[model samples]
Target: MSGPSLYNHFRTKDEILEAVADSVSALVDLSMFEDARDWRTALHEWAVSYRAALRDHPNIVPVLARGPGRRPAALRLADAVYGAMVEAGWPPAQATSVGALMRYFIMGSALGSFAGGFVDDASAYDPADYPHLGQAHLLAEQQEKIDERAFEAGLTALLDGLALQYEQARATT
Candidate 1:
C-alpha cells in the first residue's frame, strides 16, 4: 500500500508500527497454554511459540519491543501470558516483571544474529592477542548449532530463575 493509503488507515507511523506488531503477535499460538499443567509449563510453551513468531518476522522484533500500543492482539497475548504466570502462583508484580523479562529476551534473540555475525576465520583471532577466542574459527561452521544451544541455555536459565521465584513466593505465603 502507498504511504497515503496507509495513513488513511493508520493515523501515524507509530500507528502503523503498532499494527505491524499486532500482526506479528497474531502469529503466535497462545492456545498452546490452554491445557498447560502449570504456569512454568504454560509460559515455556508460550515463550517458545512467541520466539517462533518473532523468528518468522525478525523485522518486527524492534517494533514489538517498543511495547504494545493499544493493539488488541498484542494486548491479548500479553494478558494471557501474564495471567498464566499469576495463576501459576507468582505475585502480580513478579509475574509482570517476568513477562517483561521474557519479552526482552525473545526480542533480543530475534534482533541479534548470535552466530551469523561472528568472524569465523582463524586468522581473525591471533592466538597471542585473542587466546580465549580460539574457537572463533569454528563459529561459521557451527553457527546454527551454536545459536540454538545459546538460545536454549538462556531460555532455561531465565525459566529456572523464575521457577525459584515462584517457589519462594509460595513459601512466603
Candidate 2:
C-alpha cells in the first residue's frame, strides 16, 4: 500500500506494527498444547511454530519483543503457553519464568540474523588477523540453514536444562 493508504488505515506507525505483530502471533501454533503430548513436547512444538512465525515476519520482532501489550493474539499466546506449563505440574511462578525465558530466547533469535551479520566478502576475514573466521565469509550464503541450526541448538539446550530443573523441582516439591 502507498504511504497515504497506510495512513488512512492506521493512525500511527505503532498501530501498523501492532497489527502486523498480532497477525504474526495468530499464526503461531497453539494446538500442540491441546494434544496428549507431554509438556516438554508441547513446548517444543509451540516454540518451533512460534519461531517460524517470527522468523518469517522478522520485521515485527521488535514490536513483539516489546511484550504482549494489549494485543489479543499475543495475550492468547502467552496465556496458552503459561497455562500448559502450569498444567504440567510446573509451579505457577516457574511457569511464568518459563514463558519469560522462552520469549527472551525466541524473540532474541528473531531480533537479529546471526548469519546476516557476517561480511560475505572473503577478503574481510584475513587468515593472519582472523584465522578462526575463515568460514565466516560463507555464513551469509547459508543464512537460513545456519540460523535454523543455531536456533535449534539453543532451543535444545534451554529445554534440556529446563528438564533438569523440572526434575529437581519435582523431587523437592
Candidate 3:
C-alpha cells in the first residue's frame, strides 16, 4: 500500500517498470497461431497481439520501446516470434531485423497519435494562406476511420513486404 511495501516486491522503479512491461507483454496471445501454417501467419498474429497489448497499456509503451531489457516475458515473446520467422525460412539476421522493424512500428503506433487533433471548424483555417488545408475540417470527423484504415494499411504493407522478402530469400537458397 505504501512506497516501502512496494520496495519489498520491487527494489527500484526500474524493476517496477520492467515488471509492468513483462506483464503487458504476457498479454500477447501466441496461442492464436497454434495451428499457423506459415511464418506470415505467425508474425501477423504476433503483430496484432502485440499491438493490442501496447494499445491497452499505452503508459507502458515508453518502457517497452527501451527494448526488452531483462524482462523474462518480453524476452520469451521475442524468442517465439523470431523463431517463427526463422522456421518460416528467413535468414537469422533478416528475422532479427523484421522483429526490430515490427517493434518500431508497433511502439510508434502506440504513442499519442494525432488522429482527431485537427480542427473541424471551417474558421480555424485561412483558405488564402493555406489552400491545401481548406478541407482539414473533414479530418476530425473522419479521424477514427482514418486512424483504423491507416493502421490496417500500414500493417498489411509491412507484412506484404516481409512476405516478399521471405519469398526472395527462399528463392536464393
Which residues of candidate 2, in runs, are more than 4 Å off? none
Tell me the tens digit of each residue's lDDT in model 2 across 1-173. 78779989899988988988899999998998887889899988998999999889888888899899999999999999999999999999999999999999999988889999999899999999998999999999999999999999999999999999999889989
Where is model 3 more than 4 Å wrong at Cα?
2-4, 119-122, 135-138
Candidate 3 local distance difference test against the native: 0.84
The top-ranked prediction according to TM-score is 2
Window of ten residues with lowest summed lDDT in model 3: 31-40
In candidate 1, what residue range of length 10 has the lowest lDDT sum?
32-41
Task: Put down candidate 1 lDDT per residue, 1-173, tens digits, no spaces.
Answer: 77899988988998788888898899888885577567777777887888888988888888888887788999998888888778777889988998899989888888877778867688888999998988877787787677778888889998899888888999999
**Which residue pairs collide, candidate 1?**
none
Against the reference, the lDDT scores of all candidates come to 0.84, 0.93, 0.84
Top lDDT prediction, candidate number: 2
Clashes of 2: 0
Task: Pick the winner on TM-score between candidates 1 and 2.
Answer: 2
